[model samples]
Target: MSIAQLTVVGGGLVGAAIAYGAARSGISVRVLDQGDAAFRASRGNFGLVWVSSKGNKMPRYARWSREAVTIWPELHKELLELTGVDTGLHQPGGFWLGFSEQDVEARADLLKRINCEVGGEIPFKMMEPSELKQFLPGLGSAVVGGSFCALDGHANPLMLLRALHAGLKEKGAETISGVDVTEIRRDPDTTQFQIIGRDGQRWKSDRLVLAAGLGNANLAPQVGLEVPITTTRGQILITERLKPFLDFPTNKVRQTREGSVQIGSTSEDVGFNDGTTTDKIEWLARRAVATFPALANARLVRAWGALRPLTADGYPVYQGSTSCPGAFVATCHSGVTLAAIHAFVLAPWMAGLTCAPPDIECFLGDRFRDPNASFSHDH
Candidate 1:
């Protein structure tokens, strides 16, 4: 196999961010994308750069998310300068509405624990309905209370994806689209990886990164790693363009730059069925209306479902293959929130220009190997 410098399989947010980062580091890079037919979670995301309730069980993830949001401004600036695209990042802060006192208390506790675990880096407040109303004038009566986090915000996800691909091209990185990677094999003598496409085309690289989202499940094994990934469908509803009302993003809803109220997302365990259901859609609509009564008059314009690439424990899996050197796997559900770290930190480490991020050892795939290890995707 004739080795190229680097090959990244997958071209969605996760893959594009890493590829863009590597290309910016002056490495020869190529991205193999499975095309539009692939289940792209990036397209259906709520576009939140959130940090409030990220890592309740694991403080490392909370810190990682905090760092990602911290560096997001730099990433946003670089992408705009390189590609002439604006990612629509707004970081005034965000709110998580609670329907009842119990919900409010639980949210406060979760935020308190996360902030404490992360050394009080995440500043938050438990706001009463009256206090929240000052920030959110249109808040409905059903919104009993909520938690406010200064680090949370949102961006235009589609534009972010476009800027990443454009940045990759500007850096002279090659992108092969509409190609289904069927196999990954390494030559014993040269130790170079040959990635085989479904059409029999082949590409070789000295370093290979498996950032194929859910597809990592099959591809990781060939590279001597394991990624226990599952898919959960998230349904989203978009209303007709209205007067800008939301100044910040929420866990369930946000008003976009174009004035459309985006309401979403039920975490359903239906396997690979990335299709919206009437029941879920109605539930989301009611929930949104309950959160903001002004939404009752908004007309729904679009609805969609996207699969989230989730690990068993709802944390990221960043592992470099011990058996297959130069092979790495990166998977996470918070692709949008963590895009900054993926591009700035993980990319440099993968290119061998920098050491791994601090505490990255906790995310290794080896954690799943323990027979007694319990897992939960509640996050």
Candidate 2:
């Protein structure tokens, strides 16, 4: 009933993971979620805990993603044991199919560069279509080559979100839904952050975190931090339950445990328009069938779009506010892949229980302050 030690401004996967982690460490936590009205990427992602071809521009992120997948099983086991919710984590590696020889060669070069930069921590193998067909028996003739990473895997993203929420409850954290937080101000005398909802209700916390997806762009400046969050609308499609064919997840398609094929997605800079089009849906279906011919016969059951939160460079922005001492901002597109590190490593630092991660400086939003710096949000 009293002021929480830490209050998270988004109860999606990223915020829930942080709140659950801090709560497990004995910190009283409160989560404010926008509920169903928000553009929920947590439920709409491709469910890949992918690590290949990531962080080619930033070595720290490459290492961070690798670290995340390495410790994912730990969080998975802990959440399942405590909440009795299965996360459906299957980590038998994954493939990145390419339609042309040029793209496949480029992928190999990027993977090798990332691996060499990160001390060979991310081991990858380049495979021709014939070799790749061994792992993916349904590989279409259009596929020329691909790359495989042992650390890449997939999970049921909705179940992961459910399990994290359940774990938050089990750890004694408060989660408030349908709360459109409109304003935030720090009381200098009390040294507490005051959060005001749209309905004039309020709550205070000693520490505050902004992980509200695209909402972070507006909220961070209120706490004396400049975080520029960009949105890319990604459309996805799902097919009716069919016999299992996809044994491994790919960049474009993956079969869930319930036998439904999740086909996705197109990244468009449409600026907050989270709507799917017939063209993209048809394109996705064609690609899915080209990768796995059996999907052509599977009827599409659903289609939708969600916005992905990204920074200038398509990496993460994990920075604390210098003006508002206890305020922090976190945003990224790789929420599913980075969930474990965000909970285990990032939360402790935000809760003041430990120091920041060694490579945290590279992810700071301050990097965008340079007027001449050019960035690519292609991750």
Candidate 3:
């Protein structure tokens, strides 16, 4: 099975990772990106490579996320060697701070259930305020308790994107920017795919991948796949550079490598309006200060909003088009957490270098075909 040419739509974390992986496998790959005009979630991410407390009801997703973080070191090293860019990965475990005992108890129960479901593969510790204070010395009195997962960590998302793009170039993958793909058609004589752009440019390839984030909702149906993905606006705030204080990333707050604290994010169901609001910003700031009182005096540097491409259940959608062979669609909210898997696992399978990842069937879009199917985006 020779995949002569492959094209990935979108240049965000998901597409870039797939393109890099395919190119690294010695397949000719091209990436068509809509450029800055696109709602690039890769730009505005929380940068967490987290695992615990994810996939509360789905064990398959839990396992997939665990595998992604486990192989992150390999991906990090390979990208550094190939592109000379360090991604600033730190996996010293992370915290999920809670204000009230009820919140902490609920979190603990959820983690316990997830661990039981995954057969104890996910390890976590439920810590009280005293125990948590040892790990995070600056915790405010309002912090009752929290959960810690050794598998949880974070990185510089911008650097990771840069490294992936750099690795793509180093591996000889071609990237076409400013291309708004409008149509996808199959050639009757050759069964090849022709991706048509709005600017009258067309590219043909043996395989086509729709990893276009929010764009997948529109593009997937064109190739016989349905991705019921919606957009949620999440606003993030950045504090000025301070002395190194935080050692691990949390669900609500994290200090970057340059010593700036990143506080974020409210999940709002605003349709395509990725704009920040004062209420959300103030809420995030107050929460961050409560998490670490030191942040109360810190200066806020910036704030912005980005849309998360999420399915009804907040799990990923990875499936090949049965109606149109050689066509695939991939969309997920955890783009930062799953970049490694996208590159190393999904990429090879898509490129025909290996079989699909074990248990990938759980992520098929057909799961949503059931009229009685219920879903949640809590993750």
Write model 2 residue lDDT over 150-203, tens digit each, in one string: 999998888999999999999889999999988999999998999999999899
**Predictions in order: lDDT:** 0.91, 0.90, 0.91
Clashing pairs in 2: none
Q: Give the clashing residue pairs of candidate 3, or none.
A: none
User: What's the ranking of the predictions by TM-score, best on top?
Assistant: 3, 1, 2
Using all chains and alpha carbons, the TM-scores for the candidates as numbered come to 0.98, 0.98, 0.98
**In every candidate, how many clashes are there?**
0, 0, 0
Write one digit per residue (lDDT tens) for candidate 1, span 1-379.
2235889999999999999999998989999999897899877888999998889999999999999999999999999999999998998899999898998898898889889988999999999989999989888999889988898999988899999999999999999999899899999899999999999999999999999999999999998897999988888999999998888888879999989999977889999889989999999999999999989999999999999899999999998888888999999998899999999999888866787889899899888889998999774
Please, what are the lDDT tens digits per residue for candidate 3 over residues 1-379?
7689999999999999999989998999999999999998966799999998888878999999999999998999999998899998999999998988889889989999999999999999999889988888798998888899999899888899899999999988899899999899988689899999998899999999999999999899999997999988989999999999889898889989999999977889999999889999999999999889989899998999998899998889999988888899999998889999999999988887888888889999998889998877794
Q: Candidate 3, TM-score vs. the true structure?
A: 0.98
TM-score of 1: 0.98
* Candidate 3 deviant stretches above 4 angstroms: none
Q: Arrange candidates, best lDDT first.
A: 1, 3, 2
lDDT for predicted candidate 2 compared with the true structure: 0.90
Residue 102 accuracy (lDDT) in model 2: 92
